[model samples]
Target: MRLTIERGALLKALGHVQNVVERRNTIPILSNVLIEAHDGSVTFAATDLDIEIIDGAEADVERAGAITVPAHLLYEIVRKLPDGAQVRLDLSSDDPRVTVTAGRGRFNLPVLAAGDFPAMSSGTFDTRFSLERSALARLIDRTRFAISTEETRYYLNGVYLHSATGDSGLALRAVATDGHRLALADHPQPEGTTPVSGVIIPRKTVQELRRLLEDAGEEVEIAVSEAKIQFSFGRTTLTSKLIDGTFPDYTRVIPKGNSRVMTVRNDEFSRAVDRVATMAAERSRSIKLTVGDSKVVLAVNSPETGAATEEVEADYKSETIEIGFNAKYLLDISSQIGTGEARFEFADAASPTLVRDGNDPNALFVLMPLRV
Candidate 1:
């Protein structure tokens, strides 16, 4: 393959696809990227068997052909080249190496047959939909922090995405939990969206997709089946295998009759918790919340680190209640509350507590209290 492309354009495409290639691989071809030049553009594809990413850039094609080369090495070489430099790639049928030329620098990289690269087959999609980029970003940011990292509960290691009925009617929801904390966020269902069964999008796939969305256009196309899911950005596409397991019914854990309510300034509450948590034990990181008539006291006591306390003004009229919660979990949920005020509903010190944004009714969080 012989083609010429701008250094910035080539580097951007490489940056997108090379991340999917594992640093170490048992199969030689799995460590390489498949590069193809044809139809006035060049495409770079890389995969780690479970996930595949393909990105393309416009280029000057001298001759149409394809080849495979070390993904990271090529990326580094092109990245170090001068900005706006023209990069030329040349490969001959009989040669076992591909020559890369930029400015006065030239390098030869070992090549592999393009046919040896594996491709993740995209089966027929049972449901296809389109979502505004901002909408999808909101759903991921609000819930992904709660995704479980425990390996045994494989099903909980991803966000549960499905259709459900919300206060506004039909909605698309994303829910994630790690047993200690749960986060749920919803967006109004898009027009012409086909109802789909709940699917577990693995953590790694969610992270990669999030990175791609940062530079994606206004709209994104999504296709889903029982086995795989695909996201198509303008000049880039990502295909990933869905986790093969059933997520537990999350509704069972959400409390239904918590009537006690406390409304506090989110910024004030977060800062207070952070200050008191400095004295919390390393293992438990537990902080106690003493809610009273119109104020809340945040305290942390550790045998090794001593004790710390802070009082934050709040709007609460219920019976005084003292609850214990992980300081990190509290801060994480608090960050997702978009409004200035954060509302918390509690049943008792021993029961799960419900938290919500004062302004955004579409998002909610549940925190399991710890024994302080």
Candidate 2:
């Protein structure tokens, strides 16, 4: 393809799609990106068979054509080019080599057969909705830490999204659990859009897309079918096949009847947990909590190692209770609280604990207790 594009624009476009391409591939075409120039615009697409990303950028196309070229090499070359420089690309032969020239630099990169590249199927998705990337970002940020890495329980390996009657009438909820703890966050649904059908989005897609949308506040269109899902943003699109297994029922694990309430500064509690947990041996990074009338004691003891205790005065008048939690889990929830006060609800030492910001019933968190 022959096209002239701004270096910044091309790099930004490639940055979005090239990440979907793997560094190493068993098949030749899988390691390349399909570049198409047409109607004064250029598009780049890459995939690893499971996930695909397509990005389009404005350019000057002298001759409309398509070719497949090494994605990483192109990214590096375009990245190193002078800022604001314009780039011109043209095909050198039917063998698919591409001649790239910009300012005072010129190089021909070996290419693969564009015909060999796997095409992304545009399947009909049943559920369609548009959500603010910011809201989705909050949901993802709040729950991603709890995602399970254990491969055997594939069902719990991603975030569970579904329709729920939350504090707000109809809500979009995201939940992640690794058996030790669970992170749940809820937000109001947009007008005319029903709640998202209960589905488990794989961890890889969740994480990759989360990083992409961090600074993005635009509205994102989402389409979900029986076995696949698609995300459409400004000039980029992501399509992935959903995980095949079922996600375990998460509602049952949430402790609803916890009556004893504890309110603490999010930063303070997280700091105490982090400091005390350090003294815990690697095997058991456990932090024990002793709740009293007006004080809370954070303590950790490793038999082979030393012990640590921190007294953080709390506004608690409930019955005295001792509970144990994985320090990592507590730290995760507290960090996400971000500039807000957090509350903990407990029924007993053996029951799960419900945590959230003060009076913000919509955003909730649950942590299962650890026996110390």
Clashes of 1: 0
lDDT of 1 by residue, 82-169 (tens): 9999999999877789999999999999999999999899879999999999999999999999999999999999999999998898
Residues 204-306, candidate 2, lDDT per residue (tens digit)? 8897789678535489898888788888887788898787888888889888788888888878778888888999878767789999887789998888788
Q: Candidate 1 has what TM-score?
A: 0.98
* Clashes by residue pair, model 1: none
Q: What is the C-alpha RMSD of each candidate to the true structure, in Å?
A: 1.1, 1.6
- The positional error of residue 13 in candidate 2, measured at the CA in angstroms, is 0.9
lDDT of 1 at 132: 94
Backbone N/Cα/C clashes per model: 0, 0
State the C-alpha lDDT per candidate: 0.94, 0.86
lDDT value for model 2: 0.86
- After superposition, candidate 2 runs with Cα above 4 Å error: 94-96, 215-217
